[model samples]
Target: MTAHRAKGLQWRLVVVAGVQEGLWPDLRRRGSLLEPDRIGRDGLAEPLTPGAMLAEERRLFYVAATRAADRLVVTAVKTAAEDGDQPSRFLTELGVEPRDVAARPRRPLSVSALVAELRATTVDPAATPALREAAAERLAALAALRDDDGVPLVPAAHPHRWWGLYEPTRGEVPLRDRDRPVALSGSALHQLATTCSLQWFLGREVRAEPPATAAQGFGNVVHVLADEVASGGTPADLSVLLERLDSVWDSLAFDAPWKSRQERENARAALERFLRWHVMERDLGRETAATEHDFDVTLEAGGHRVRVRGSMDRVERGPDGRAYVVDFKTGRNKPTAAEVERHPQLAVYQIAVREGALDGVEGFTGRPEPGGAELVQLRIGAPKREGGDELPAVQRQPALSSYDGDGEWVGELLADAAGRVLDERFTPSPGRHCDTCSFRGACSARPEGRHVVE
Candidate 1:
């Protein structure tokens, strides 16, 4: 019963629970919807003075304590969390030590808790045989107990229902078959070989990819705008392109107004750079064969068949009549010149072209030889030369040739990467990229995450 309802009553024993700060005295000023305090005079109801409110709460507490003729017990809990409970100041004022009381062991509050304790006692090797037998009998009795409606009250106490004794749903099966062909993408080949393999396994194999962020959304819109302009859906006019951007700008979520504005402006700069690059290429007599070209090819790597499927961003027929692969990169960080020279993704695309993946397509009558591939970084500005126009940075990977050593190295890298994927050997390779990895919390490379695997 509430303290207010028990006023002036006497009892042999009384127990006050939840005597924690913010609960007992409850100093919060509760406004009334009826506004009875303002009935006499004034525009709004007046709150009780702090001193008066304290006195009233104290009086109620005193009344509750005095009702117990024999003994009165006040309880509180001190929780471990930062915003957890604390004993009320009233306990100290009543000459009770809050610390000693809070440190005492809590009583079990449920049948399940009692059953768990009894089950533990029954299995304890240190326990006497007689004690273990007594606990087992009690557990059996609890399992047979029923409610007024005949439903078993302690259903979990049944031995057959124990969790630890249950058999696993799938008994000891390997995740992937060793002889099965490993399906891969052009981009996955690059990430697995050049970056961390554990990251590739968790993200691709386990399908634990992180949620898309604002930066990813921004990149997507810019890529779409670039595609539209390239396909002639939207003109090269800045005003027209920006109008289209504004139409879908609200779809992307940004942390703040300033961040949204900044990203929008950055996207504008990217579009301008793309237009500049496109116009420059057109003026140089280059023709775009396809905007988004799809390809699927199978390669024999490490004595295993690896199916590679991916889409190229843009394919252009150079003045020399050789096909050129153009990959648009909207990210700020551009790959180093050395990394670009031996890039796996570009090499895979070149291999696909040589293997007739693009043969009999709209622009190609027969197999078109890959002249070269280049990463067009729209977010990075090219360093201005004395007589050059401002444009996006372009990192080119020279065309692979059978006679040159470049093609042989690419084949070796592909085989090595394919072997790792097939064997499911995803050893964590730490690098600067680990700082942004989503699986860092589960990765064994870090000391804290090591416990997860153990």
Candidate 2:
């Protein structure tokens, strides 16, 4: 009870808890905005001085102390720089010498705490065998006790509640059974097979990928705008594209206003690059067969058939009436020509095309043979001539027909990837991309993630 509420009350023993320096004599100014307490006294002439306020607090403390007729106990913790609980000055003024009191050791009052104590006792090396057995028996009794809802009162005491002690949810079965085909997308082939397989397993297989960033959002907007332009839904004009970009530009989060503006400019440049490329394709007698075309096909790999499925950004028909793949890149870095030759993502699309992925699609005349593939790097500007305007950089990969045995090594990669996935062999392969990988904390190759495997 508060000191004010114990005015005329008497108790056999009274405990004045929290009699600390700052709290017992709270020196902060106290009065409503209307100054009601000062109305009958000084009429708000001036605020009460520190000495006057201290005197008032001392009198209140005296009232609380006098109410205890027989015995009184005042509590205050030892004061230090870290612990600021000092005994109130009133204790010294009233001839009470503060002395340290040894705290009584007691068990915490909670089911979890009790379970922890019992568990510790059962496993204690210093305890006798009989005492440990008694503790185990008590824990079993507690485990048997349940509330009306049927949930155990002490969950930790129950053996069934312990994780990592029982068989896994799927037992010893692989993620994808041996007989079943490992279904993978073009990008998945890159991450799972080419890059880090463990990263792919944790992020894609378990769906533990991190949230998207501002750069990702920017790339998404550019891709959508490029698609709209190709589909004739939006005009291929700079002003119109900027207007469309402004509609959702503020939705993306950036660290600063200048960064946001810079990204906006980059997006504008990407759109401009797309416009130029589109116009050039028309002039070169190349027609867009499809935009964001979905494809799914099965291929023989590593003694097992793997299902490759994904959407192509754009598929074009060349003057020779062969299907060509064009993938727009918003990332600042562009791969070298040699890397593009064996790029897993591009190889997947070409393999799908060879497997009749877009044979019956509209605007695709004759056979859907792989003519060639190119990465239209929108983020990286092309080498500018003295008087020429800025253009997008293009890195081309020749048609599969030009490669030896029609690029059969790509099939070997697919088979290897499929075999690993079927066998659930996801070993961590550390690379330059590790810095941006989301599963670094769970990867065995990383020092920070070593504890997980250990």
Candidate 3:
């Protein structure tokens, strides 16, 4: 059993293997942050000290060994030939009697067969001569150790079969520099000033997030339903909406059965609320003209033209001939009016629609003149009314707004943010969001001339 999962677990015969010098306690490396704790200039607590780390590792191993109901057998390799393979000092510290046991051949402990298997899969059998020689040496050493008392060695194979046998980039495969503007999305650029530019750079260049949770998944399904309904193909009946919602829900692959059921019920309630909202919009002479409209808008930022791109969830035409941009939020965590007033996304979209960003289209002969933006929030829960029956209520809480037509804030904000990015200085601005940041493990808020250097 692995050490992590073996905690508080006991067996009639408990054998703790691989108690070697380089492992077990696995002491901290020489240059590691383990000398004395020091807070870095970034205000992030940078701790140090190998002694404390070793003590903690020892405590865990000690607990694992002591969790024996009947007998405890601690074993290590005593490879006299290999310089580093020595018994763990913890066994000697316990004053346990030394006893040599013969090695037993097992299905999982095949060293020669592993090399053969890898060679068979390789494109060229003779390419991995170094790997084969190393495998041979390990097998010979294990054969010598079989005559002595030590832990039986097992070959922990590499995760990939063709790890060492491959050609580096050749021919037409040319690596490209990441800095060249595959320009960052509008949403990405907007978030840079709010968080740190470093966070955005890390996410764009290094790694991406995994599939979202159930709530997010359900929200995406609702987005698709909204798109379909806005396209004017589907009839706006409750049964029709539910049927489409159920079909979309069924199309999604949910790993958890209970989450699927729960999200479905929640999505149904949200869709019902959305249908009611749609009726009100129609009554107010608002007609959805666009759904999932993609746009690439160029704006003056930092004395140069920078391209910003994103998709609008919905665009509607009012009876007064004014056009509106609408975005849907399935969760109740709607931004306040103050927050929305200065929000980059709304401001940018407002300027884009005003500047004929989505002008030429196949839908109609006319173009949209910016009215403003709205965030439609869908509720799947029913909050109780004061001094009333406990009946459930589904509702759409919308935040509708209109711009005064003074659209210069969009240019100023974008110019400042884009200038900082183009300057190539990425600094971490720590705040409440840092706690939930996925890149928090590697986040260091050190001073200038440190990681902030491009």
**Clash tally, candidates in order:** 0, 0, 2
lDDT of every predicted structure (CA atoms): 0.82, 0.83, 0.65
Candidates ranked by TM-score, best first? 1, 2, 3
After superposition, the stretches of candidate 1 with alpha carbons farther than 4 Å from their true spots are 1-28, 32-49, 59-181, 362-365, 386-390, 402-404
Q: What are the per-residue Cα lDDT tens digits for candidate 2 across 214-280? A: 9899989999998998888998898999999999999999999999999998888788877988898
Identify the leading candidate in terms of lDDT. 2
Error of 2 at 388 (Å): 8.5
For model 1, residues 1-454, the per-residue Cα lDDT tens digits are 9999998789999998888888878877755777566555556656778887888888888887888999898887777796988877789888866546434345476787888788888989999999999999999999999989999989988987765455425426655565766678888989889998899989888899888888899888988888788888889888898999999999899999999999999998888888889998899877888887889888776576777789888888877878888999988788899999988899888888887778876766578888989999888888676113258998899998531356887777677778887666788988877888898888879765774443
**Residue 414: error of model 3 in Å?**
0.8
Query: Which 10 residues in a row give candidate 2 its minimum summed lDDT?
Result: 162-171
What's the TM-score of every candidate structure?
0.68, 0.65, 0.54
Return the lDDT, model 3, position 137. 67
RMSD of each: 7.7, 7.9, 20.0
Return the clash pairs for model 2, or none: none
Q: lDDT for model 1, on a 0 to 1 scale?
A: 0.82
Question: What clash pairs does model 1 have?
Answer: none
